[model samples]
Target chain A: MDIKNILISVDASDNAMRAVDYAASILANAEGVRVTLLYIERAPNRDKFDDEAAWLNQCKLDHDRVFDFLKTARQKLVAAGLPEASVHERTVLCSAEPSIAQTILDVQQAEGFGTLVVGRRGLTKGEEFLFGSVSSKLVHNAKNCAVWVVQ
Target chain B: MPESVRELVERFKPPVSVRTYGTVFTDTTEFMNIGYGDVIKLGGRYYLVLGDERERRFGMEDPKFWVKRCVEMESGQYRILKLEFQESFDQHIGSLTITCHRSAAKEARILRLVAGDMRFMQGLGVRDERGNLARVLERVAGRRLDLNIEDLHQSHREYFQETFPGILQRFIGACRAIHHLHQHGETHGDIRRDHLYVDHKTGEYCWIDFDYGYDSVENPFGLDLFGLGNILSFITGKGVHTIQDVDAEALGITEADCALFFRHRVVNLRKLFPYIPADLNNVLMHYSAQSEVFYESVPELLADLEPCLENLRRA
Candidate 1:
């Protein structure tokens, strides 16, 4: 009931961003709610990159974009009245070959978040179909938390 | 034209196939066969009455009663009157009468009754085609398990003890869900054990059976709050006494004064479930008390639950 810790998975799409906006609005009124912004990047192929160095550089760039987006989102939350201290951000290199849904579920369980908020649509068409336009799969699969899909 | 004929007409058995989808009659649409009889499909969707002497006798009058009873049972919708037999009845040996209550047919057509509504009749184990009562299918799966708080303590003790934290967390979440629903102007009127389905696979609990649920914001929280508290009490072996006994004890009042102390005397989760961790207990107590104070809304209680959950996780 007390949604102190919120886990929102964003993919930088307009819809995903809108979902983040909705989540911020819902939690903004609370006195001390902590929001964790998670962005997952599909890991580039080790074979595609000539060597580990190339892969590392590409990963760094991907992390930068994720961080930059989080930075922008963090500002939005603060602008919406959330304390800067209460907001946390993270980006992970999710190996493209593995299922993203499985990864999200693992992260959610590990994090022990009270609520999981996701956009109805994500970045890729495949992602949209697999996770649904609004992450309906998460709602059906996730345990112990309420899944909110913002239109 | 004798006394027996008059008597037979006056006391004719209630139309046995009254509510049934199809009835058989003569070319003139006069009654041919009736009550608790098997409906034999004559062709594609058409059916005929096929039962022995008892069913034939029942068919004589039961259909009329069935239509009348259904009208009386569900008053709001339209009524179904016995429809006159059509030319189709001429082909059959015994004329097949197609009787229908107009209002009842309209109600069924408009309302789109779910199987659950007819489950009671199904439970009675009456199946003679025309699709048995909804209850029959449900009962066929097996009668529902009646779970009391004692069962939670005994059979599910390990599951409860191991997953107490999650249970408390979900309970708080349920409170929040109810709170949200209230804000949207809805109240889940019945919060009994039967209405709540706990998925053993995921430890998630969902509220179902909304037949009597109300879509009003006013006092929705109390509808489930008291029931939830009592369930918790029952689970912890607090005894199956009336709400007065448990509520009075929790509130520290005598039975005679329970009416006055009713809402105020509700027990906190920590007090009721002593084995809960101190921090978690604090959170439970905070929301439990808040539920009493804001028995009308869930927002405040949810706000309290949020922080307590975080603090418990940290501890």
Candidate 2:
């Protein structure tokens, strides 16, 4: 019941920023509370023109973008009064083999975080039907850890 | 057995025991409250008795004026009639009444063409002398489908698939009705999925609402066709639900992407549904296309749609 560790999944989206803001507001001055910002690089599916080099280049670009997003998120938390020492950043390249959702859950289990903070990109009913969302998957799958999905 | 005149007359008189007709509309939350009306039955036929005495001093000048005018000007079965509430104080508190006619398949076709009953609720609409309005809708004896498109798509997906041929037929029927409007030098300016109605029993489609319609416009039927495109996409996609729900960011459909549509760069529906028929996707693309390269006339659109519908029906 004690708030100790919080893992937030960051993306280059307003919703992701909103999640960070939510975590910062709730855990701003809480004693011993630590924040881990996790950025997952979902492996891009290859098309006809996309060779190994092109795929790697795209990954590198995505990594840099996500890295920058993570840095901004950390700065936001520190500014909100959480100690810089309490904030941590983690990144991983999730191959399509395990699925993006499974990768997220795997990391959550390994780290043993108490709470997972994730942003919900509002998908349409049709979109949701075709592709089940990551936040939804985590909430349903992660039974032990508390998952807060900020829209 | 039909009721006698004496029985019908007695039914309309005093105690106002018309409760068994349909139901008194106490819940006006979902209803359009222009005036109060009781859905009553007489002589085995249904009638709506709409009453307003608020403007009695001013000659009860609303539906009474329009009803009187319509009776004088238009011939045949008058949709409005003067209801005498003998016990009521006012000498001339008139009720606009409409007789409900059971529309057969043949009648539904003619109704769609002549009545413009597609957009509005199927009913007899009466406006006051000052142009205020009230409607006495026909009692639909058959099942009424869900009002919202989202619910219809979600709940009736199987129905749509099973009766897709018939659905396509109705789609063409709507297009034909639009064609009729265009032929008369009129335009249904605001054409959307909401304006189109489908009869659950008859599978008939009607176009309603001419509030935004006009006798003539600068653009020759293009906007209506564009609206038809929107309707087609709505049917194919089941329903998009809301504009905000659109994957605008993912589909690159922002203001920057607006130019792509204008440049004849088509957005495939198959991208949303990979197994979607190519013919159906092509029809969708053609309708959603900005240029006249696809269709300039309703007939042209129909020409394309008929074959597509046939092919889809066969498939």
Candidate 3:
């Protein structure tokens, strides 16, 4: 049923790998289950600073690192028993959206992905209070899409 | 909680039990005599209560009777010390009856919930050792919307054409901020023109007093939406257009064509000014005496406001 393609977001973090592991465990034998590893190369918010060159350099390094994580996630999914031909990698170079969760959903909607998977990063209430909890934002705002959150 | 005047007075019992570090002024003859240079210990920290802030341009500022302007003894930064003031009110619009409250404890809980939200007044819900809950908010540098409007010395038609559209856009921003608070399962219990502050530095319409709220099981945000409606009407009419000020000779309509509150405040704007678009006027009329259908929520109010904003922008 329209749940053929599942998009799993990877960020080179241990929690993101857990999401990859969960996806791998589910698609061991499910035929025609296409898995896409999504890496969002988010632009860092530079609020007070005006240094253009340093910011661009940092963004490039961050993009390359996330792109490497995308390949690693794809390999993990294939090695865990999914078909090598079915798993694909996608990297989106995105500006800072209102929230990262919104960017993930926007890409999912545009590419016709049926299912969305995200990893709930381990952040304390104090940290989440300062910076928002992305996985929580996704869980609340995701509509017309089945979301599998790996805590 | 207060059903009588005595109970209401008891609710706002002044903090006269503070064991001052030094006897600065012992003139305790005046009624409720606590004034400038007074030191009170809260949460083991001392604060020096300041006099009513004055402005050379506008004379003495609006004295916040509920809260006092104080300076933290250690930091020297100004802060708003929220005092124990509990109040509630009831208002009716047509068939809808709304009850609102001024709850200090409820505001403390809400401040904790919306601690990280920038749209709200930044503060900490502090308590003393013996368990007296209070709040110490940052002394924000901003202009209250009420005073901001009072400073605008333009005619109603001139303001409506030139500056009102931009202000309406900002008002929409405030409405969205209210929606954010509602999303977190909290209501800005009191929505007043003075409660909405425009930060001088950020230009963001930050909502200040959240200590006021309602517990309408039928419509939780009904009073809030009505409060927002009143603000909208106030801004549109340049000020509160009492029924006495409006006339058939000046505006081409009488009391029969207009909707007035129980206190005889004019609600209907089409009778006063026919130039107001029907789409926008309809939303304003939703809180009138003749209003059969009412705005149930903030989002419902926003749905009508957004299009009206777009239409105004286009025109």
- Most accurate candidate by lDDT: 3
Query: Candidate 3 docking category?
Result: incorrect
Per-residue error for B264 in candidate 1, Å, reads 13
Candidate 1 C-alpha lDDT tens digits along B1-315: 234323332333235533333333212122344333212221121122223212122136333422111111111221222222211111110122112112212122212332343221111122123431111111122221124233455434354455444555766666665554445433444455455545444545555332232211112244455455444433333333334445545544332321112333433434434454564444334223233222224555455556655655555
Candidate 2, clashing residue pairs?
Answer: B62-B128, B62-B129, B63-B128, B118-B206, B118-B207, B118-B208, B119-B207, B119-B208, B120-B208
Evaluated on chain B only, what is the TM-score of candidate 1?
0.41
Predicted structure 2, TM vs. truth: 0.39
RMSD of each: 21.2, 23.1, 16.0
Q: Judged by TM-score, which candidate is best?
A: 3
Candidate 3 residue B187 C-alpha distance from true site, Å:
1.6
Model 3, residue B183: C-alpha shift (Å): 1.9
Per-prediction interface RMSD in Å: 25.4, 25.6, 17.4
Candidate 2: segments with Cα more than 4 A from true spot: A1-151, B1-34, B37-149, B152-163, B241-267, B287-294
lDDT of 2: 0.54
lDDT of 2 by residue, A10-128 (tens): 76678999999999998887888888898876644332111469658876887788878888999999999999999999877764335456777888788788788899988632223
TM-score of chain B of 2: 0.52
Chain A accuracy of model 1 expressed as TM-score:
0.77
